[model samples]
Each structure stands twice: as C-alpha cells, then as structure tokens.
Target: MGDTAVGPTDLGPGRRQPLDPLDCGGLELDGALDLLAAGELTVTGRMTDASNATLYCEIAAGESSGRCVYKPIRGERALWDFPDGTLAARELAAYEVSAALGLGIVPPTIMRDGPFGPGMVQLWIDTDVTVDLVALTRSDDPQLRRIALFDAVINNADRKGGHLLPAPSGRVHGIDHGVTFHAEGKLRTLLWTWRGRRLSAEETALLRGLAEQLTGDLGRRLEPLLTVTELTALDARLDDLLDTGRFPLPSGDWPPIPWPPF
Candidate 1:
C-alpha cells in the first residue's frame, strides 16, 4: 500500500460479529448513517500515517455491522491555525455540505461517541487499489470536477491526491476532511485542473440550491459545528462563485496545493 494504506485485519474470535468484508458494497446512505450513529464501535486498528489518530473500527448494532474510521476529538493535535479539538466537527460539516450539494462525494459520516469518547465516524470506503492516483489527479474526470467545486465551497485546506478514493463501481469519494471549512482562503488541492473554467449549468443550479439551504436548514445544521464568522465566509465564497460564474483561481496568499501532493 502507498499513501492510501489500509491496516492489517485484526478480526479474531469473540469480536462481536464479523463486519462486512472490505469492498465497495455497503448499506444505502441512510442505513449507513444510522449504523454509524448507533453501532457499538470497537477499535480494530489504526492508520499510523495519519496526522491525527485515525482508528479503523468495527461497528455493530444487532445483526447490522460495518467498518468505519473513527477520529477521536481527544486524539486531535492542536493546529496553530485551526481551533483546538474541532477537527471531528469539521469533518462532519464537510459531509453535510457534500450531501446538501447532492454530490455524494463524501462517504456517510457522523459525529458520535466511540470507544475513545466523542469522534467522527465515517463509513470506510474501499477504493480500487489498481487506480493510479497521480494520473487520476491530472485527468479530466467529472467526478473529480464535482469534488473540486465542493472543495471550493468548503475552503478545504488539504485536498491531496491520497484523499481521492476511487471505488470499484467507478464512484470517486474523498476523505480526510478535518482541515476544512476555514474562514480564510485556504483551498489547496490537486483538482485544480478545472481552475477558472466556467461552471456547467447543472453545477450552477446545484450551487443556487445550496445557497438557499445554507440560509434555511443547512445553516442551522452547521451553526453548532462552525463559527459565525466561518459560516459568513462560506456564504461569501458561494456569492463569488455565482457572481463570477467560474471556478476560482488560486489566491496567492496561500500555497496553491498541499505539499506531498499525494
């Protein structure tokens, strides 16, 4: 395994119930969200390469079970820029915005209490290991383009190549969204291939819908996770996108892309 590494199996005797095998198949989005929100989470392994502690866990509620990544708030290291211990909430916020846009670019994620206390639990996406990530980053994949639009909205500060998970069913999902939703203009990513391109009619329509949702339902949902200032900045970004009717060009204030692109 390279950047997108999976930990070794820790399943053995008396481990509650064996979870569904690592693959692209899983429950529907609603069911997956329920499973993650109510399941009895058992930490099975960890992704050592992650900046913060990322536990690969088995979540079981009755006969329903699945695999997910659990990032504990306590495990989050303080960042000079991001507020302390808010990474888990930010990750959940990213999922909410993705869902609101109807992009489904992020796997189902929820904020819940795990074995290690409160954390963000997301359905683990099994990616197609054969896909070359570097090549995929440079390609003009529509899925990646959708993600680029979503990233711009969230102010995602770290969208590396490794974050792109290409499923076997041809759907691309992005992960590791803890460092997103910053109030500043920190939209570093590898999906800049679509930078400055005119937004498709469909994309523009989706943004318009999202703008309305933000002021109504979506804003209420995100209020608890993000600050007032942050939410205001999000609205401003949306306005800029719709006003310009084009993808955003990189701001010289921050690095255009995250270091170690992969």
Candidate 2:
C-alpha cells in the first residue's frame, strides 16, 4: 500500500480534495430515519455495488424533504479498491471538485451527528432516471462528445455509460470517483474513443483556462486532498495531455469499464 496517512496538507479545494471535520459548516443532524421501517416515504431504491463504502437511505430533513442516501466515511474496509483502506475525506474532495467544475454529480451534505459516524447526506438519484450511456452513444449525439471531453480534462477513471445518470428533467450526472488521482498511473474506465478529434474552438479555450488555473490557486487549494507524490503525478499527467495536444488514450488492457454501477 501507498501512504494512507491523513495529514493537514492532504486537503484541497477541488471536488477530489479531502473533507475535514472542521469544514462542516454547522449542518446539524436531527435523527436517523429508517427508510426500511417507514414505507411512508416513496423511495425507489437499488443497491450500488461499485462503492466500497456502505450506503443507506434516510428522510431528507432539509428544504427537499424526501428520501436521501447517506454514506458514512469510516476506517479501511477489506474489499476497498485501495488496500490501505478508503478515506471519506478523499471521496468528499472529488465531490467538491465536481461541484466546482459545474459537473452534474451528487453533492454530499455534511452532517455533524448521525447514526453512522461523520458522513455525507445527499439527494437520492432515482434508478429509473439513469440511462446506459453505452446504449445511448450508439447514436450520434454531439453532447456525448462534449461530456467525454470534460471527463478527459478531469482525468476521471470511471466514465462508463452506466455512471451517467439521466434525470427526468433532462440532466445527466456522474458518480463514484474513489479511484481518481493516484501515485501510480491514472488507470480505469473507457471514455476516450475520440482521440485526435479537433476540440472545438470553445473546448480548446476551456482547456487553456483550466490548465492555467490548475497550476495556480486551484493547484495550491487541491494540495491538501492528495499526497506530494499523488499531486506530482497529477501535474505530470495534466502537462503531458495538454502539452502533447493529444486526447488521452486508455493506457492498458481490455474490458475497461468499472464494475457495479452505482
């Protein structure tokens, strides 16, 4: 295993940055609602196997009071993707980055006290609302290409069709970003079939802006969420992709999809 130590510097500002208890902005948890016992709340649910962290359902106590998913950040689990164990801080960091990039992702609502330990409460995405992107991409939709481009910029390792959840309101969302930004190669997923395709003038412009900001305040802010080695790896990956003027290609073997769509 790699260094799994949680240090002060391992917290950053992007969606992939680590979340510390100090950052919890006074969001108090009332009580845990047993969705299983109380069928009163109409919640369409399914188990997500891709997540190493166990998830459960509860009644949303905020403005949108309905069914919500609760994920507690705990110690290392045996079946985790990283042998050293999983960190809730890292998962929260990814969400923060996604939120900053204006990507459609399930943002975690930090709660102070709950049945489980320090965890995140987020809006529950309906299973029926999600569409299999692999099936949808069989047709020619330019938007799919745009999404792919964004995925590339973020260095997302698990951009499978199943990860794209389409809401009834005509919006799409991505989830499960635990394996991103490692010291080793950024391995996993299959979102790069459009290599060498000329990015639109607008897309090219966006990349330029993002790259410039990444090395400045953005990079400095994200320094806390990852290790020195991991952060160095991230900078190297970004430099290679942006400088080479080539769309990133899948580095290795076949069956490049992440399993158990959540």
Assess each prediction's global lDDT (C-alpha) against the native: 0.82, 0.48
Residue-wise lDDT of candidate 2 within 97-120, one digit each (tens)? 444454445334332223445444
Estimate TM-scores for all models.
0.91, 0.66
Minimum summed lDDT over a 10-residue window in model 2 is located at 28-37
Q: Residue 224's C-alpha lDDT in candidate 2?
A: 58
Best by lDDT: 1
Poorly placed runs, candidate 2 (over 4 Å): 1-51, 59-66, 79-87, 105-113, 127-133, 137-140, 215-217, 253-255, 259-262
Candidate 1 off by > 4 Å? 1-24
Model 2 TM: 0.66
**Candidate 1's TM-score:** 0.91
What is candidate 2's local distance difference test score?
A: 0.48
Cα lDDT of model 1 by residue, 134-228, tens digit: 89999999989999999999999999999998887778888999999898899999899999999999999989988988888678778988999
